[model samples]
Target: MPKQKGPIPITGTVKNTTYFSLNGQYYERRKSSLTAAVVATDPAFAASRRCNTVFATAVAIARTIYPQLPTHKRIAGAFGQLTGRVYQMVLKGMDADSIVTAILGE
Candidate 1:
């Protein structure tokens, strides 16, 4: 049974809880069990597949030119920004080589 310390309160872990808030609420977080295979093969995760495709394409381009980028404590931040912008372009069905040219000016 849940330990209810106040009116309209439900507390305590029952099962499969990933996260919970002390403000009289609970959240089930899927911290594990979601593998790449699950995302790729599950028909229910079609949206995830599409999103992943866009981001992957962006990262592929970013990686090819990453070593040429200036180094810094927050170097990954620039990579992230590049990936995000490229992701949007990919979602719009832009060509890969054109994306490289647009981002790198070459």
Candidate 2:
């Protein structure tokens, strides 16, 4: 992936900001207080949060399942690719459980 010139600018006020980068895409800064309200009232936000949770869990599981791998960079790169593919499959209406099971060879 190509590097960006700088951090992507986000519009609007946010509090308790945290930054996350996935597959070269940076997530928007989150406001902790407003996040609770948005999660409660927004279907899209809820789905996105659920998806992030699932991917985070899957990355942890993958680390355990493939513990013998060498190097932190390699492990992170592999999981990053795995997460992106799994996310795409999920977005395409595929079952995430099946995708993870297949990836884990379980």
Candidate 3:
């Protein structure tokens, strides 16, 4: 039998600094506290967000079906290809929901 090896030590820098202000007055640094429902219904983010949600759901379903595959790269490639086709369909004036349904088959 081969000799056992010990675990290697990990070395990294530890920074102790507060990069963000907790004060509500700093608009630029402030992050949105919007909930998922609010974001889903918001007109400004609706189209882009809907597309992202649909694409993500599709990829998740695909990953579930093929769990042995490296899903990150596969999902990324699927998203790119699906988005390209969806973009073309959108240019021809197709509704976002219909496009998502067609691509996802639901």
Candidate 4:
């Protein structure tokens, strides 16, 4: 990655409201949720209640940017999906927002 940019500033009240709604659900769904994904990827990322809070917040940000994703399917599974090599290559060089835009459209 070159230099990652700050999050795009959504425009107008409509966009703001839309983002709020999407973010709210994303936060709620994963608030108390934890997965082996974090544990395996970041050893410093301990599996604790606080970790879930941060994970939920991260999930919320991802969801707000990619509202089309199915909430249930967003969580990691017994067999990881996006964490795999294929998914990584497909999304290579793309920031999360760009990836969401490519996958889910505007």
RMSD of each: 6.9, 9.4, 14.1, 18.6
lDDT value, residue 92 of candidate 1: 81
lDDT (10s digit) by residue, model 2, range 1-106: 3222464644444566555556656565545555567876787687778877777765655555454444563554686776566656655666656765666662
**Local error of candidate 3 at residue 61 (angstroms):** 17
Distance (Å) between predicted and true CA of 56, model 4?
Answer: 14
- TM-score of candidate 4 relative to the true fold: 0.24
| Model 4 segments more than 4 A misplaced | 1-68, 71-79, 85-91
TM-score pick, better of 1 and 3: 1
- Report every candidate's CA lDDT: 0.69, 0.59, 0.52, 0.43
- Candidate ranking (lDDT, best to worst): 1, 2, 3, 4
Q: Write the per-residue lDDT of candidate 4 for residues 1-106, one digit (tens) a residue.
A: 1222345533223421322224323211112244578666765764664556544444544545443565765665512333342245333544556555655552
Best by TM-score: 1
Model 3: CA > 4 A from native: 1-76
lDDT tens string, model 3, 34-85?
6688877889887888778656554544433333344564564665565566
Ten residues in sequence with the least summed lDDT for candidate 2: 1-10
How high is the lDDT of residue 101 in model 3? 56
Local error of candidate 4 at 50, Å? Answer: 24
Candidates, ranked, TM-score: 1, 2, 3, 4
